[model samples]
Target: MKAAKAPQAPEPTGDPAERLRELKAGLARAAALGGHPPPSLIAVSKTVPAEAIRPLIGAGHRLFGENRVQEAEAKWPPLLAETPGLELHLVGQLQSNKAEAAVRRFDAIHSLDRASLVTALARAIDRTGRHPLLFVQLNLGREPQKGGVAPEGLEDLLKDARNAGLAIFGLMTVPPAAKEPAPYFALLRKLARRHGLAGLSMGMSSDWDIAASLGATHVRIGSALFGPRG
Candidate 1:
């Protein structure tokens, strides 16, 4: 039997609000096909100006992701003050020194990868009394330039995170470019199960529907939602 197809992103539209709606509709459909609830759509606003992000917020999207602490700090604070219920996520590599700042600024962080980071985040949480949701990033592709814990080191890291009193909410990864992402997504799901984690923060603008169908709990989306960043 043929496998069910992943949902396709809706045709591009001039309106951001329309694009947001269509993208979400596609995600919902993909989840329905898999008999699972839709993944949380994290509109990756990295490098995107606040004005461009405002329309999506105006359209009622509350979840957003950013790649850098400074950039998010520069724009999101004002937006958060003006809009209640906005959740900001840090979706990029985090510096151990910036753990406190990241915990202070983001509602969730999708890149907890090393022992030092684990210690830093635990300390940050204790000091700040802000327990932002955490995801253990895995370098599934084993890329030299990537920021996730090597798969072999994941168990030890999780143990360290737990011992340090940090609660791990999920696993996150970025599949290698130009490669099929399904196997990576599926592997992530299995790893999450092995680790007793429920959240799977994988997929992006290019393949989130496939991620959704394969049981992603969160998808980081950027260019597809905001168009090519200038």
Candidate 2:
């Protein structure tokens, strides 16, 4: 019997458009390694000016992520108008007060981790008639600085979201920085399975191939896709 081959990491070149192709092809290969479907790639466009992102958009990449609602509000409207079918995601810590704004601007929110957020999102959805996909962020490392719910608190948060009529499509996490991320990704997959959730939003630029191999449904790639933030 032959040993299995490891997935090749994406070669992100300096040009954003070319890098997009490289990353997409790389992710497809990686997903195949684990027999999982290719995960959606969210170009982490936070802090990247519209002009720089336009090239990638022109290259047929539509999904993007922003770290702040206000920033996204400033730049995305015109870009969205110019390009139909563009989907935006909020990948930062969202203030409960900004729920309505986020719901109005984003197609998905990857930072739903608390009861207050669930309540706010529910109200926002009611007012805006928009149901942005939500993902529960888990603090697998229990890091105090991060924005994820502690592992022990995930169940209660999910219950709260359910009660508030918020739909959670997936789980998200940022493993402890500078540590081996495979275990954390694996654990997130287990937790999502235990709860009967289907989406797994794990991995970033450094370990996206590993995340895909572990069944991540979404991988947020910033620097790898857009080059380093300024």
Candidate 3:
């Protein structure tokens, strides 16, 4: 049998708009190879200033992910007011204390990995009437230094979130660094299936093509779109 080929990574060059186009094209090709629809691209604007992000916004990209609530609070409001149909995703480790603010500011939250956060976010959702799409970040590698919930604890967390009426969107993970991400992506997909969730917010600038091929519903891209942080 012929070996399945890998999709070519997009050249990480050009302006933000061009880079986004290239990235989307690459994602589409990978999805085609895997017989899945193209995943949504979340231009990770963490640490990227609004000026640098405007071009992508102007180019019609709306979904953006931010790592810090404060940074996003400072940067996205004005841009969102200017650009209609914008959606902001909080893609970092969220504090239980910041649940209200995060609920108010972000349209989606991708780091729901604990019971405390689940409770806090559910309260915030009720208080603010904002129920952002929530994803359970799984620590597939079970690294202690990471912020995700270990695989063994995922079901309990999911139960807590559901009991609190928080809509569980899907699963997200950042595989151990310097390792091939395919296995990790496949694992996340399998877990999502088992739990009856659909979205998979795996993949970053480095391994998004692989993530897309494995049925990612959302792929987060950062440095590749905005260049290196200053």
In model 3, the clashing pairs are none
In the order shown, the candidates' Cα RMSDs to the true structure are 3.4, 4.4, 3.7
lDDT of 1 by residue, 1-230 (tens): 55445434445466888888988898999888988899999999998999999999999999999999999989988899999999999999999999999999999999999999999999999999999999999999899998999999999999999999999999999988767788999999999999899999988988888898999999999998898878
Clashing pairs in 1: none
Candidate 3 residue 188 Cα shift, in angstroms, is 0.5
**Residues 1-230 of candidate 3: C-alpha lDDT, one tens digit per residue:** 55334433465788899999999999999889999999999999988888999999889899999999999998888998998899999999999999999999999999999999988998999999988999999999888999999888989998898798888999999987766789889999998999999899988887888898889999999988998778
Worst 10 residues of 2 by lDDT: 2-11
TM-score of predicted structure 1: 0.95
Question: Which regions in candidate 3 have their CA more than 4 angstroms from the true location?
Answer: 1-8
Model 2 clashing residue pairs (backbone): none
* lDDT of all predictions: 0.91, 0.91, 0.90
TM-score of every candidate? 0.95, 0.95, 0.95
